[model samples]
Target chain A: MALRGRDIVSIRDLSTEEITEILDHARSMIPVAEGKKSSSALEGKVVATAFFEPSTRTRLSFEAAVQRLGGRCLTIADIGVTSMRKGESLYDTVRMLSSYSDAIVLRHPNEGAARLAADASDRPVINAGDGSNQHPTQALLDLMAMHETFGTLAGLKVVLLGDLKYGRTVHSLAIALAQFGSELVLSAPRALALPEDLRGELESLGAKISDEPELRRAVRDADVLYVTRIQKERFPDEGEYRSVAGSYRVDASVLDGAKPQLIVLHPLPRAGEVDPEVDRTPHAAYFRQAFLAVPVRMALLSSILAPTRGG
Target chain B: MVRELRITPIRNGTVIDHIANGLALDVLRIIGVRDLDKDSTVSIALHVRSGKIGWKDIVKVENMELSPRKVNAIALISPSATISIIRDHQVREKRAVDLPEHVTGVVRCPNINCISNQGEPIESDFRVVRRRPVVLRCAYCDRQVTDFLRHLA
Candidate 1:
């Protein structure tokens, strides 16, 4: 029941019970975050945000979460602007940051950067986002959103649209969703489809997964349309991103044939993927979803940094 | 008498048999054994035609206990390899090589960008997620490694 000082690098490390516990805690913190109630569970703790890559939502959410818990935040927003630009290795950077904080939240461009940082640091390291590998906190917030919206995650028809291969959020979400017995519809371009082995593993977990190139047919009867941007940054060639960028846009027109109660979710910073017009509709939960990050992350941070009952 | 292709018997050492043809060198590389010492005798036979399974390679190492870790490396490189552990000129243990839970300090990640490949004093750790399909997921990066690369280490 105690998760204090734990490094949250991946959802794979969390058991179903622990995940549910975190969700329960997140639910409790939601009212506090919306200014209906207040609790300073993480009162004297300090969180360090060490972002080696560019991030606005993830970084700020962690800061807001820490402040909401009556804790302070130390941020190194740009690695290029820090001592790292002067040739400090990631290990040294983490070692230095660990000395100043209780927990370190890392967003790095390398796949295993967070793990490496955790190994080097004295404090717990939370992976905010790691290069197309994992974003565990994002997965947590996503599950929290689903639970809040539908009241249950079991047996939901979720369709993940756009760039499965390069989308870190979807990758982590898919792994988390597998535990809930959710059927998945993956719609992406052939070049951007989920990896063959990930698909096989999900199938083994009894997730009814089907890949479709066309977005329209895939989202026709979906309960949740989880949209992700086609990350141009991950493409090896700029021309490849250019070729596939416009294929899976979810505009206002695209949702005409969608399920009546379809909740459209996007882990945003959108680039022409979800049209601006769709933001006014009832289906648009993306902004509210983004705002939910604060409470969910606060719950996560509090649980991770709180004192142990046995001790 | 079937005209036997002669192999000098190792006096008191392990013999790894049933290695897929052309993978003996790869197995050797994974085990970090490029050249055998003068005191430690090693014999390798490659591309030997086998009646049961087309062609195979065999490696014999004298005065050494073939660790399960080494056997795992052999499994990664050559899935069909059978390990025979010899003690006092007798086969003590013999079995088909199976993947290990965590293969540390052996069989480096094939990904060029992997931290293990960068000579960072980090051991390459792989968890055997699936045995039948022979998939090893890297502990650090979560990269699925199917093929063993010689140049990685």
Candidate 2:
């Protein structure tokens, strides 16, 4: 259960026990993260964030996790201002960073860049997000949110809505939930629905997934409703993006017929997908979900840097 | 008038039979026919009619035996092919080539952005996750590549 020197490249790499272990540790970290209890677990350890892509939430959360645990962060100022702009490859930058850091958290534009960086570096490389491939920690925090609402992850009717194809968070979350034997309902318009390759992969992993475009079909009798913003950049045609964006937006009124316990979660930076009206409703778990990142990530940082776990 | 067909048998070698028509050359390239033993001889028959298949090709190599990898690599080009190991002018062992669980250094990833395709000194590896309508999953990027022949390294 001690994830000492392991590379966190994909959520698929973790066993169910390991994921549960993480969630259990996250539960313990809540008091410490809230400053009710103090811990100096990671006093001297150093973490480096190599974000090649622009990020706000994931980046800041990791820095907060490390700092709150009394560890220093060697965050890369900007890749554009660094040697990367001078034509340095990800491998070279990662190897150089490994010399100065205990662990490297990498976010790159290429799908397998974290894998390449892990192979090159001498330290554990946690993938923040590599292109549209996966974001493991995001999935972990998301599972934490689900656990907070449902009390457990198994057998819950889970509905994933909007931009399933390009949304990395949804992709990782769906795969993680499949292990718990959840009946997945994929609700998105045809143009923005989950890709067939991923759907087949999920099916192979033993997840029952159905295409339910209408929110009503998915909301009824569902325990969890996961909504995501549909990126306009993903659409090649401006008109096509316009037509699908408004149809997927969920407001407070949309939840009128939904189950009272139906928890609506979004991996944020919403762009007209979830209406502002929904934010005040009991269904909105995203804001609380964002705050939960602190405790969950403190668990990751502490457990990863603990001396008991071997590389 | 009736015509008598004459064929020469090799003492030791492999006979790759029932290759699809117009792919004999591709099969040769896939198996690295150019790297054959100096003393070995290769005989090829292309665009020939067969009872089992509409149009077929056959290749015979003298003084050489093909490995399972080579056989699998050849199967990518010609799935219907049968590889027969000949010994002392007799077919000792024969079987149809089935796609291997993994194919490495045989076909390059079609994605140019993939690590295997980039100039990284990495061998191209693919997992044959599907058969019938052959699908090769790239080991690096997990991209499904269908056009197997076009990306041969």
Candidate 3:
């Protein structure tokens, strides 16, 4: 299937083969992502980075991806200075932006905001992050990092720890990993466990899921330890947020019993959920996971912008 | 063998038969009871015995025909409903209302965070996940919406 003129709003929108193809293209883009080589795949094209919400890594990652592909960027890093503050709807903003750019990268504070923008824009739309709903590219990049380390997504034991309920990155990543037939062991506080509906949906997709209450016990036999931060903004009450804050911490002691090849991944902007001392260990792949965003996003942008470029 | 009619037959309107048990009022709301003509006569029979189904409700109106949109709305609350258009005391058209594959603009998404409920210009679009006991999921937010009556648009 042709990916040209398509929107990347949810990881669920991609199939196993399409995801594999994207990852394969990402492998070839590593040199470009590292600035060791450059490509004009998106030359003479303008990609708009519309961040209605605050984001440091994803916005910079998309800008880096676009620039590395030899494309210029039209950025709106702040919503306060835009027409949105003057009572403009997201639809109108996306419609106007679609007229000026070849493709759009949208990040909004509302759930399903990217889905709404995709319908309004004529050009392809990439969901950078939409509230606590979905961040497809982040999941894709996470998959890229895992595939690079392990050489395959199938049959891997992945332990998802921390805030599963409100972490958008985990939601998409868990679903994508399940699609690749990975065994998932969920470890989190009872209050912050993954939603039951999502668990059922993942099971229906043929995922083998088990629950482990202890983080240390869950990590003992895991291949990948994906940690997430407890989000204070997602809780309805301050007391509820306070109760679960600092519930699980991954330190060097946690990995003492684990296999040497076990890799720890985190979608950064950490709030001390993973200890800084753990970064010195060989198990720290979160930084590499962060850097993989460029190649994965570059693969997506090139596939959408230049489909006939022999990806 | 013939059974007596529960309500007087209309000469030039519509007779909706085989509505699910105790759903006449919900059907009324779905068709917008307030939007009906004041001059038209409306009759409803609740919990009437039926040979096909155990018990069903029936509704008859005089001098008013329901639009296709209203007929589709009835399918959500009462899947077994059959509409018979009467013209000069004869059944002009008779057909069972069908639950459309895709429901649009009729029922609002119940999720507060859904894009359709964010005061945007986009209409609420849902894919019918199941029939019999109808289930609809929002196209934008992927939230399953089951109670259709309370969230009617």
Best by TM-score: 3
Model 3 misses residue A141 by how many Å? 0.6
lDDT of 3 by residue, A185-274 (tens): 999999998977678889999999999988788999999999998988778789999999988899999999998999999998899989
* TM-score, chain B, each candidate: 0.77, 0.88, 0.92
Clashing pairs in 2: none
Write model 1 residue lDDT over A165-197, tens digit each, in one string.
989899889988987888899998888989776
Worst 10 residues of 3 chain A by lDDT: A302-311
For all candidates, the clash counts are: 0, 0, 0
Error of 2 at A197 (Å): 2.2
True lDDT of residue A164, candidate 1: 96
**Candidate 2 residue-wise lDDT, B94-144, digit = tens:** 999888899988888776656665555457778898887788887656678
Alpha-carbon DockQ of candidate 1: 0.38
Off by over 4 Å in 2: A233-247, A309-311, B1-22, B29-43, B47-56, B60-72, B75-102, B110-121, B130-134
Q: How much does each candidate deviate at the interface, measured as C-alpha RMSD after superposition?
A: 2.1, 2.2, 1.2
Ranking of all predicted structures according to lDDT, beginning with the best and ending with the worst:
3, 2, 1
Note the Cα lDDT for every prediction shown.
0.83, 0.83, 0.90
Error of 2 at A196 (Å): 1.4
